[model samples]
Structures are given as C-alpha cells and as structure tokens.
Target: MEKLKVDGVSVSFGDNEVLRDVSLTLMPGELVSILGVSGVGKTTLFNVISGLIRPSAGRVLLDGQDVTGSPGRISYMLQKDMLLPYRTIEDNCALPLLIRGESKRTAREAVREKLPEFGLQGVGRKWPAQLSGGMRQRAALLRTYLFSKDVALLDEPFSALDTLTKSSMHRWYLDIMDKIKLSTLFITHDMDEAILLSDRICLLTGRPGTISREIVITEPRPRDGDFALTEEFLEYKRLVKEELGA
Candidate 1:
C-alpha cells in the first residue's frame, strides 16, 4: 500500500495559488524528491503535507486514511536547524516524545539509545549552540525521526551547508533512512542533490507548482560521489534542467 498520497490537491494563500491539482504517491520506504526552482511552492507543498496549512482543495492520505487536516502524523525538517539553543541536544530531541505524553525518563532513554545511531552519542548533554552546523542538522534529523512518524517532509534541509558537507550529509541521510525504512518527501532546488538522494525525482513547473516529470532512479542503493559522475546521472540532471528552463 502507498504510504502517503496527495490527491488532486490545490492550495492557495488568499488569491495566490501555490499548488494546482498536485498529486503524488509515496510507497513505503521510498525516498521521493520534489525538485523545483525558488518560489515554485515546494516548501508550501511540504507545509500542506505536514498539516501546517490546509489545502484549499483535495485530500492527503496516510496509510490509506485521510489525514488532510489531521495533525502530527508527519514530521517536518526545515533548512534551518531550528534547535533550541538553550536546551541540551538530548533534551531537544526528546521534546517530541515529551509532547506526546511520554515520561521524561522514557523519552531520555529512547533518545540515549538512538543517539549513537545518529552520530550524536556523547554530545547529547551539549547545547545546540556548541555543535557544528552538520552536527546540528544531524540532531535536527534525529529529533524529527525520533517522533516515529510514518512520513518525513524535509525542505532543503542541507542547502545551507558547504558542498562537501552537504554531500556527506546526503549519504548519512540515506543510510539512516535505509535503517528506518521510512517514507520521505524531500524538497530541494539543487538538481544534483535531488538526483543523488531520490528513489524518484518529481520535477515541478515554475510558479504555481505541478509535477512536470517523474524520473525513477533505477541505480543500486548506497550511491556515492562516484555515482554523480556517471553518464546516466549527468543525463538526468541535463534533462531536468532543460525541463525547468535552468
């Protein structure tokens, strides 16, 4: 069964239409990337999917149930780390579970057990301000994933990092996602990043967004820097750029 479905969805902010009849399906364990240029409503679509905003029309289904206006089934990560500067890393990561009424001890235990897997083992006691940009992002991702949401909506989560760091984090994200097997919708303006991480790339047209093309990445998993240099990868990037008028 599809993990998440956006059916005939349309969204508007007053008279400014953002999404028009946008539809897509995310199967379980799939990593789908929505690639579009700036101002193309990619983040708006993420917001709609995560229930931060209600669509002007249509339904959002999660595990075959309509969650169009439902709350909290999806976890969202943004470009900014958005970590609470004053809270310890572990505390910040555990906030989601605490909000769900889990006891503090239970939440801490869960975060402690998962910290090493997220590469945050010994730094849980440190504040976000003390961590590097990449570490902050890792903590943010851990916080998002710790919620155990069925779907993760990531909006340009690594765009702020240096090219080298961004590339490394891409690999880390894929590794963690593979371990968790969660469905994900990632939005990015970078064609290379989209191609590198997506199981399928959904290219959106300019302005009011709609899927213009869907390209499947049939390559094997655990793709690395070498994969980026392949003829097929370059061809896909070229085609997507041409389609987007990049």
Candidate 2:
C-alpha cells in the first residue's frame, strides 16, 4: 500500500496561487525526489505535506487515512542540518524522542544504540561543531529518523556539502536507507543528485507549480559508481529537461 499520498493538493497565499493540483505518492520504503526550479513552490509543497501549511484544497493521507494539516505525523529535515552546537550529538539526535516525552537517559540510550547503524559511532558525546558537515548531516538524518521510522521529508539536506562530501553522503545515505527502509520524499534542484538517489522523480513546473511528469529511474538502486556516467543517467536528464521546457 502507498505509505503517503498527496491527493490533488493546492495552495495559495491570498490571490496568488503557489501550487495547483499537485499530487504524488510514496510507497513503503521508496525514495522519491521532487525536482523543480527555485521559487516554484517546491518548499511550499513540503510545508503542506509536513502540515506546516494547510493546502488550499486536497487531502494528505498516510496509509490511506486522511492526515491533512496535522503536524508530527512524519519526520522532516530542512535544508540545513540545524544541529545545536551546544548539545552533544547524542542529545541533538534525541530531541525528537525527547519531544515525545521519553526520559533523557532512554532517549540517549536509543540514540546510542543506533549510532553505528547511522555511521555515527563514537560521536554521540561530541559537540555538533566538532563534526564535519557530512557527519552533522548524518546526525540530523538520525534525528529525523527518530521522529518517525516509516517516513521522512528531506529538503536539500546535502546541497551545502562539497562535491566529494555530497557524493560520499549519497552513498552512505543509500546504504543506511537500505537497512532502515524509511520512505523518503526529498526536494532538490540538482539533476544528478536526483537521478543518483531517487527511485522516481516528480517534475514540478508552471507558474503555479504542479507535477509535469513522473519519471521513473529504472536503472536500479544501490547504483554503481559508473551509473552517473551512463547513458541512462543522461537520458533521465534529457527527459527532465524536455518536460521543464515544454
């Protein structure tokens, strides 16, 4: 069954419409990417999905139950890692569980047990400022996962990293997702990043942003090093380019 579904959603600020008939679905354990130009309400769509903004129309459903405008139902990581410098990595990652009212010790213990699984072993007691950008991102992702193991919404979480770091993060994220099986829906403007990480890409275009196409990346997952250099990658880019141009 589809884990999360956005059904014909629309959003507007006063008379200016920001989204129109936007809709998509994330199946269990699937990683989906939403691609669009800046200021096309890509973030707005996320706000709606995360229940920070109510859609002007349409329903947000999780596992077939309508959950529109309800916060805390799914995890969300903004563009920045947003880690707290003063807090220990373990403390930072435990914020979600803490918010759910878990005792501090229990939260830390839960975070500690998953640290290695998240490629974050031995860093729990360290400050966020002491970690590298990639490490911080992993910590942020761990925090996000703590919110809801079933689903997450990531907004350009790797965009700020150096090329090598971002590439490394992608590989690490894929491996971790394989083990955790979290359903992810992320927004990114980078074509290569989208193609490299997503099972399917939703192209959002138009003055009032809407899905222009749903392009499946059929090359398969845990993609190899050469996958990016392959004709298949170029083909996906070409298709996205054409759809954006149309």
Candidate 3:
C-alpha cells in the first residue's frame, strides 16, 4: 500500500488561493522532493500535511487511513533547528519521546543508542549552543525520528547551512533515512539537493502552487556526491529549471 496519498488538496488564506488541486502519493520507503520557488505555498503544503494548518479543501491519507487534520502522526522538521537553548543535546533529541510519555531514563537510553548512528555521540550532554550548526540540525532530525512517525515532512531543513556543511549533511541524512526506512516529503528550492536526495521530484509552479511536472530519479539508492556530477543528474536539474522557468 502507498505510505501517503495526498488527494486533490487545496488551500487558501482569505481570498488568495495558495494551493490548487494538489495531489501526490509516496510509496513506502521512498523519499520524494517538492521543488518550487519561495511564496509558491510549498511551506504551506508542509504545514497542512504536518497538521500545523488545516487545508481549505482535500484529504491526506497515511498508510491508507485518513489522518486529515490529525496532529502528531507526521513529524515535521523546519528550516530552523528550533532547539531550546536550555536543553542538553540528549534532552533535545529526547523531547519527542518525552512528549509521548516516555520516562526520562528510557528516552535518554533510546537517544543515546541512536546518537552515534547520526554522528551525534558523546555530545548529548552539551547544550545546543555548544554544537556546530550541522550537529544541531542532526539533533533536530533525531528528535523528529524519536517521535516514531511513519512519515517525515522536511521543510528546507538545510537551507541555513553553508554549502559544504549542507552537502555533508545531505549524505549523512540519506544514510540515516536508509537505515530507518522512512517515507519522506522533502521541500526545497535547490534542484541539485532535490535530485541528489529524492526518489522522485515534483516541480511546482509559482503563486497558486500546482504540480507542473514529476520526474523519477532512476539512479541507484544511497546517492552521494558522485551522483551529483552525473550527466543524468544535470539533465534532470535542467528539466526542472525549465519547468520552473528559472
């Protein structure tokens, strides 16, 4: 069964329509990228899917069950880390489990067991300010996964990082996702990042967002820096750029 099905979704703020007849599906263990310019309602779509906002129209189904307007089933990681300055790294990563009523000891244990996998071991006791930007983002991602949500909604999660850090984190994220077998909806404006990390790309038009085109990346899994330099990858980026009128 499909992991997620977004059917004829529409949203508007007051009289200004944002999304129009937007529909898509994500298969189990697949990573899908949604690419569009700023103000094209990409972030708004994330909000709707993550239950941060109600869609003006349409339904969202998760694992074939209707979860429209339900909060907490889908995990969302935003552009900013949103980490609490007072909380330790381990505590921050444990926030999701804590909210789910897990005991502190249990939550810390779970986070510690997975921290090394995410390159965050040995720094759990440090404050967010003590970690580098990439480390902080990794912790945020760990927190999102700790919630045990089947679907992850990433909204420009690496946009704030420098190019080098963003590239490194991209590889790390792909490895982590592979290990966890997550079904993801990643939103971004970077064509290279989208093509490098996604199983399929959904290109959206500006303003009232709609899927202008969809391209499947037929490359093998665990895409890395080498894949970014391939001719096929460059062609896909070109096609998406043309579709977006860039």
- Per-residue lDDT for 1-246 in model 2, tens only? 999999999999999999999999999989999999999999999999998898989999998988899988877887689998889999999999999999999999999999999889999999999999999999999999998888989999999999999998889888888889889998998889999999999999998999988999888778866899988889888888888883
Clashes of each: 0, 0, 0
Ranking of all predicted structures according to lDDT, beginning with the best and ending with the worst = 2, 3, 1
Ten-residue region with minimum lDDT total, candidate 2: 217-226
Arrange candidates by TM-score, descending. 2, 1, 3
What are the runs in model 2 whose C-alpha is more than 4 Å off? Answer: none
- TM-score for each candidate, following the candidate numbering: 0.97, 0.98, 0.97
Query: What's the true lDDT of residue 42 in model 2?
Result: 93
The 0-to-1 C-alpha lDDT of every candidate, in the order given, reads 0.89, 0.92, 0.90
Please give the distance, in angstroms, between residue 152's alpha carbon in candidate 3 and its true position after superposition: 1.4
lDDT of 3 by residue, 1-246 (tens): 999998888999999999998999999889999999988989888888877778989999988888888888888898899999999999998999888899999999999998898899899999999999999999999888888556788999999999999999999889888888878899999999999999999987867899888999999888779998889988988888889999
